[model samples]
Target: MKGKNIFQEKETHKYDDIIHLPHHVSTKHPQMALSDRAAQFSPFAALTGHEDSIRETARRTEAFLELDEDKKEQLDEKMHVLQEYFSEKPEIMVTYFVPDEKKAGGAYVTHRGRIRKIDTYLRRLLFEDGTEVHMQYIFEMDGEIFGDTE
Candidate 1:
């Protein structure tokens, strides 16, 4: 009585006759499992994959970079020097842009590995580990072998 409000007292009076009654068990249908009953009251996703779509849209990506003439010339010179030292299989670091498979923009990745061979037909820099970087996507190349070329 001390903790109960007047409204609560009136509400309890209305259900006094049935307050101690046993809960009804359906005779027409079998009882549901506790897990299944709990699942009915559990939180659910009405929009399904909408949250994933929103997260994917909110994700950031980098735009592909276009090198200017001066930079392009420098890169071309580096490529020439790399070819000269190709037979030596020099270890090098290459910075390149990788396009996102599901989006317009991409990301710049720097890879360090030993050069395997340059595929002229494919126009890609192949690595000893079977990694390939397309020539057009290359941003920069660096190595001890290109010290004099730079």
Candidate 2:
């Protein structure tokens, strides 16, 4: 009565008789489990695969780099030095680019391992753990074995 509005001024309780009555139980069906009941209000994905497509589109990758003649020569010199010290089993860090399987470009990854072998014929650097890094993919190499060799 203190805050009665025009719409409610003349209105009476339409369900006043049933307003205080307890809620009726459904005898036709048993009570639903809490998990299943909560799932009913959970969000539904109307567009299937839409999120995956967006994620794939938003995924980023790097382009493969091409080293200039001088840089390439320098890398080759470093490789030669590595090959010479291969028998000594030197510990070195090699940075190389890996092409993406699903994209046009990829990324550069660095690996630190002992020198197992430098297969010139196969054009790959083999590690003690049987990891084979392609020579062409190598960006730079550094270790104590390459001391003062530049």
What TM-scores do the predictions have?
0.78, 0.72
Q: Which candidate number maximizes TM-score? A: 1
Q: Please provide, for model 2 over 43-148, each residue's C-alpha lDDT reduced to its tens digit, 9 standing for 90 to 100.
A: 9999999999899888999999999998898888888888787778999999999888887899999999997887889899899998789999999889987788
Model 1, runs deviating above 4 Å:
1-31
- Residue pairs in collision within model 1: none
lDDT of each: 0.93, 0.88
Per-residue error at 116 for model 2, in Å?
A: 2.9
Clashing pairs in 2: none
Candidate 2's clash total is 0
Off by over 4 Å in 2: 1-30, 129-131
